[model samples]
Structure formats: structure tokens, C-alpha cells
Target: MENHFMKRSFLTLPLVIALTTSAAISQSLPPDDHQNVASLQSAADQGNSDAQLKLGIMYFNGQEVPQNEAKAAEWFQKSADQGDENAQKALKALFR
Candidate 1:
């Protein structure tokens, strides 16, 4: 049970950080997902799992964009395909 909890904590830590950091950033910006969204999409299209993971979070939390779990799952899938552990964990949670 302890080990399971540890694993859960490890898995969720990235998302927590992503949310917190995104919130901090959002408080200062126009909150338009366009620029970053385009950049993130470009990176994802170029096979950058890090960008894909970040984009997924942005969509999931509606931080910089409207909430869209399906789009979030799609981006997470792309990142997970590149062996991004955080993306894989997020995809698992979204699917569940």
C-alpha cells in the first residue's frame, strides 16, 4: 500500500507542477492559447514529447485553452509514443 501510494505520488507530481506553473504563468498573460498552442503543436509535430506533454496539460486544465480532454488525450498519446513517462501516466488517467 505504501509503495502504491508512492507510485501514485510520483505519477501525479508532474501534473501538479504543470498546473501550478501554468497557473502562475496564466495570471500574467492574455491567456490566449494561440501562440503557445501553435508552438507546442509544432514541437509535437516535430516529435518533441516534452512539448506534447505540456500541450496536453494545457488542454486538460483549460489553462491556456478551452478544456478538451480528447485533444489532451491525443497529445498525451503522441508524447507517450515517444516514451515520455509523464505523458503515459497522464494518458492513463485521462482514459480512466
Candidate 2:
């Protein structure tokens, strides 16, 4: 059981780091950089899995957006539905 959890953590750590970094970068963007942020949101809206995951991370951490677990779950679910393993794992972690 412990090993299973560890493996799950190991697999998810990278994804978490990547997503968090992406969200952080977005948050740090200047107001004039709304184009990039808009582009990212547009990608997520168009069903880009990584973009969805990044938005999920952003919502989860209150980065560019407010912290909203429900919104985070929604974005994570969208990414997971697209067969993103990292998003699937992220959703699981969010639920737990």
C-alpha cells in the first residue's frame, strides 16, 4: 500500500511541479501580457490538455485566478477526459 502511494506520488510530482511553474509564470506576467494569458485560456477552452492542467493548477493555487477547488476540479476533469494521465492523477489528488 505504501509502495503504491509512493509510486503515485513519484509519478505526480513532476506533473505538479510543471503545472505549478506554468501557473506561477502566468501569474507573474505583466498586465500588458494579457495576450499570453488569454492565449493560454483560449487553449484550455479549446480542449488543450496541458493548458487545462495548467489552469487547474492556477485555480488550485490562487495564482492568476482565485483559489477555487471546484473550478480546479472542473479543469482537471477536462484534461483527464482528454486522456491526460497527469491531469487524471491531479484530479485524484485533489479529491483525496
Candidate 3:
């Protein structure tokens, strides 16, 4: 019985380690993409130029938000109006 227990323990060790490692990795990753985009959108709506620029980039690249040049341009324009140089450049590029 003791030998059988030892064999079982050894067999379970790797499985235990793999599960622990997976949990840790998952915890370290960023939150859900939708949640992130929603938070960014909220901030942008509140007139945060940086958030607007980031949201614009996300929309432009379809990263979380749908790919919509119109939405991206709108967000970029909002940031540009607030004197965000990056957003200004992006807006110009989008229009060009």
C-alpha cells in the first residue's frame, strides 16, 4: 500500500504543478479585452485625451473594438482637439 501511495504521489506531482502554473499565468494576464475596452471608452467619454487616443488605436486595429475607421477618426479627432500630438498625427494619417 505504501509503494502504491508513493507511485501515485509521483504521478500527481506534475499534474499539480501544471495546474498551479496555469492558474498563475492566467492571473498574470490582462483582464478580458471587452472589459478593458469598456473602461477605456468610459475614460474617453469623460474627455481623457490619452484614453481617447488609445481607444482610437484599438478601434483602428480592431483590438477588442470593432474595426471602424469612422469611430477611430472620431476618437482621434477628440484627442487631437485636446492637443494630443500623437492623436493629431494619427488623425492626419487616417485622413490622408
Candidate 4:
């Protein structure tokens, strides 16, 4: 009975190790900047209010990107269309 139990344990040991090692390897991969940018760009393109607001702020502050008031206003307008108070405030600030 003990030998039988040991055989079963040995059989599962490799599988358990494989699963853990694969998970570790997958977790170790570096974050993809392009993937992040693509996700943000897609959300912005789809007129997501939050994404638009973030894009507007990025433009306004040149954070990890370029600064352009016109672009900022454009994105803020999109977000404002969704009734975002912050975007509305930004738009007013930019235009006025």
C-alpha cells in the first residue's frame, strides 16, 4: 500500500511542478508597453469617457507622451459628451 501511494505521488509530482513552473514563467514576463498603449488607444478610439479623460490629461501634462492643447480639448470634449464633470471642467479651463 505504501509503495502504491508512493507511485501515485511520483506520478503527480512532475505535473504539479510543471504547473507551478509555467505559472511562474508566465508571471515573470515583462509588462508590454505596446499592449498597454494599444489598450488605451483602443479605449480612446471607442470614445470611452474615462479613457478620453486620461488621454486629455496626458496631453495636457505631456506625461509619457506629447503635449497639445488642441488635442487635449478634443479628448476632453469627447469625455464631456459623456457628462464627465472633470472633462467639462478641463474643457472650460482650456477654452476660456
Candidate 5:
């Protein structure tokens, strides 16, 4: 039982820290930036790696959009494929 608990804690600690950090970052955004979200989404859809990273953060944090880990991972992968270092780190932290 102790080993199982330790394993679970180890597995979840990174995810918890990622979510917490993402939430803090999201909360720091301005209130009137709704349009920014749309623009970011548009850029992300257009294969802008920076936008993809931002969208991943937003989705991961449940900021302007609903929180979705799968969606976050998808966005991160796109940016990572484009050679975005931040996105690569985010993906590693998320999946590791």
C-alpha cells in the first residue's frame, strides 16, 4: 500500500505542478483580452508555434477556454514539432 501510494504521488506531482503554474500564468492576463484569445486561436490554427504554445497553456489551465489536457497535449505536440523549445519543455513536463 505504501509503495502504491508513493508511485501515485510521484506520477501526479509533475501534473499538479504544471497545472498550478499554468493557472498562475493565466490569472495574470488582463480581463479585456478575450479578443486576444481568439487571435491566438487563429494563429495557432495557422501553425504558429508560439500561438500553439500559448493555446496549450490556456487549455491546460482552463483560462478563457475549458480545461482539456488532451487538447493541451495536442497543441504542445504541434508546437514542439515546429521546434519550439518552450512547447517541447511543456510537453515533456506534461507527459513525463
Candidate 6:
């Protein structure tokens, strides 16, 4: 049980960091997803799972971008494919 708890914490740590980073950077992000989001876009395009997850949330919530379920799924799928635990959870939640 202790080991399981540790593993769960490890898995969730990235998610916590991603969410915190997203919130920290949100104010500086472009108001439009299509516009410049160089740091995030660069990392995501390079297949960074965390950035992919962030993009998924932005699209899903219309945080800084227009709400588009399709785009959200697309980003989440990309991260999930990379074995990001948070992204996998996000994809599941997005579908349901």
C-alpha cells in the first residue's frame, strides 16, 4: 500500500507541475491559441507530454483559446500516446 501510494504520487506530480506552470504562464500566453504561444508550441511540437497536456486543457476549457472538443482530444491523445499519466486521465475525462 505504501508503494502504491508512492507510485501514485509520482504519477500525479507531473500533473501538478503542469497545472501550476499553466496557471503561472497563462497571463502571458496569447489570447488566441492560433497565435504565438512559442514556448508551449515549441515544446508540444517537439512532443513534450506536459506541453501537450497543457494545450489540451487550454482548448478544452477555452482558457486562452476557443473551446473546441476536437482539438482538445487531439492534444490529449498526443500526450497520452507518449505515456503521460495525466494526459491519459484527461483523455478519459474528455470523452466522458
lDDT of each: 0.77, 0.80, 0.72, 0.68, 0.81, 0.75
List pairs with backbone clashes in candidate 1: none
Best candidate, lDDT-wise?
Answer: 5
Error of 1 at 65 (Å): 1.4
Give candidate 4's TM-score.
0.61
Output the worst ten-in-a-row residue range by lDDT, candidate 2: 14-23
Q: Ranking by lDDT, best first?
A: 5, 2, 1, 6, 3, 4
Best by TM-score: 5
| Candidate 4 lDDT by residue in tens digits, 1-96 | 999778777665543453345335535778662235467769989988878877776676565568787887898899999998877766765553
Query: What are the models' TM-scores?
Result: 0.64, 0.65, 0.64, 0.61, 0.70, 0.61
TM-score of 5: 0.70
Instruction: Return whichever of 1 and 6 wins on TM-score.
Output: 1
Of models 4 and 5, which has the larger TM-score? 5
Models, CA RMSD each: 5.2, 4.6, 18.0, 20.1, 2.8, 7.7
Candidate 6 lDDT score relative to the true structure: 0.75
User: Per-residue CA lDDT of candidate 3, range 31-85, in tens?
Assistant: 6633376787899999999789777776766666688889988988999999987
Q: Mind giving the per-residue lDDT tens digits that candidate 1 earns over 1-96? A: 999888888776766675567556756677575356778788888999888877887888886689998898898899899898878777765544
Clashing pairs in 2: none
| Count of clashing pairs, candidate 3 | 0
Better of 1 and 5 by TM-score: 5
Candidate with the larger TM-score of 1 and 4: 1
- Number of clashes recorded per candidate: 0, 0, 0, 0, 0, 0
Candidate 5 regions exceeding 4 Å error are 1-35
